[model samples]
Target: MNTRFKQLLQLSAAALLVTSSSQALAWGQIGHRVTGEIAELYLDADTREKIAALFPNQSLAELSTQADSELSNPSEFWQQTWTWHFVTVPEGNEYSLDKHAPKEGDAYTALTSSTETLKDPKATVEEKRIALLFIVHLIGDLHQPLHSGNGTDRGGNDVKVEFFWQPSNLHRVWDSGIIDNQNLSYTELTKWLSQKITPQMASEWRTTDPKTWIKESIIIRDGIYPEEPKLTYDYQYQHIATIKQRLQQAGVRMAAYLNEVL
Candidate 1:
């Protein structure tokens, strides 16, 4: 092969490796976990029926894969899909903005965009379902601490550090480190969190709304800014419970939103 072709092959191999590695920690894992929990608690009779009708006999993994691929390209559905990929910062920085400083954007934009795709007459049922599912996932992502990161770090992507003696970025830590450290299955973690949730707590957690979710996530980002992330088992130990709670909530709320919509 020519040099260019050789480089292309190398890049493809690396991408595949990264994809395989990410399967365990991808946004989908967290989202689906949340969706499952929320589905259990929040999905109504109709939405549950719809989901069952659309995906009978399919695993969550299968549905998620199908949704992601369909969402990769949408009908002339909404404003660019890329626009929905960000989170908005709350007002109060020195940037001299209004009371509502919009740093990133809102989950509403994403939901609206996804809705547009779903509503497009030309859109396929699978495409619409996938778009709706993405809306479900993005709602959960908007609540993750790093997902609402400052423009400076691109949500900690710029902050390089080591996680358990492994070289990694700060963003990666929040994305996967804490959850992976627990060594619990997603169901176990969800059950663990579900037990702690009181009716009142769930009630309050569900009402915060998406804009509020982003604001809350931004606050968390401040605390998570790694001074020197030499995190080992001890560090993970210190925050293991907290991490599980956050991840669990992500799933719970995602399902809640979808249930409401359906």
Candidate 2:
């Protein structure tokens, strides 16, 4: 292979490694990988067609690649705006007391934004692709329990600790430890997960709201935080099934979100 092709393959390999490790633990979690997969799958035909219109000569794969790159390291402007969409209206005083729930009318009230933002009509094809991709990941992130935790912790960043004998911070461990322990490729992991997903689950998890997702994560997060210095395979397997389910759901839902607005 040419040097450029070799480099591309290496980059893809690295990304795959990053994504697989993210499953067990990472700043992002399976949400990122699942959403990434979904964004690649769920874009509406019209949006896909529109993006093609903008780039008459480019293949869909190429466009998607460009989009992923643009979103790899989002700008501050993109982060804040995309972050807001994940906020949900808190249920009531009951939920209000729970810091995770938003107040009746918070600055980030989700209703204010449409899924259309996921694919801005006026932006360039690459720009829209980037936006859509980010939304996919952000939606998944919103569903992560730590992402919705108390602001002071920076989503577990404040918690100092070790994991699996590794000298690491709380957030860092969860971001990339346990899953890194798996030592698998993205294709291998996805295949293993896809085989386990039932049709009923795929249908049920397809939704746009992030609050409900976050609530689910909060429950999982609660169960995960035990006063222990080391985590074992048992701890990892405790929710392996659920973790796979979440990733599958994220992919399907991400596609739905883009299909609706794009």
- Per TM-score, the best of the predicted structures is 1
All-Cα superposition RMSD per candidate: 9.0, 9.9
lDDT of each: 0.55, 0.48
Backbone clashes in model 1, listed as residue pairs: 34-251, 34-252, 87-105, 88-105
Q: Residue 50 error for model 1, in Å?
A: 1.6
Give me the displacement of residue 229 in model 2, in angstroms: 2.6
Task: Give the per-residue lDDT digits (tens) of candidate 1, residues 82-147.
Answer: 334455453344111243334332445545555555555765555555555556556656666766
Candidate 2 segments exceeding 4 Å error: 1-31, 38-114, 118-127
What TM-score would you give candidate 2 relative to the actual structure? 0.64
- TM values, all candidates: 0.72, 0.64
Best by lDDT: 1
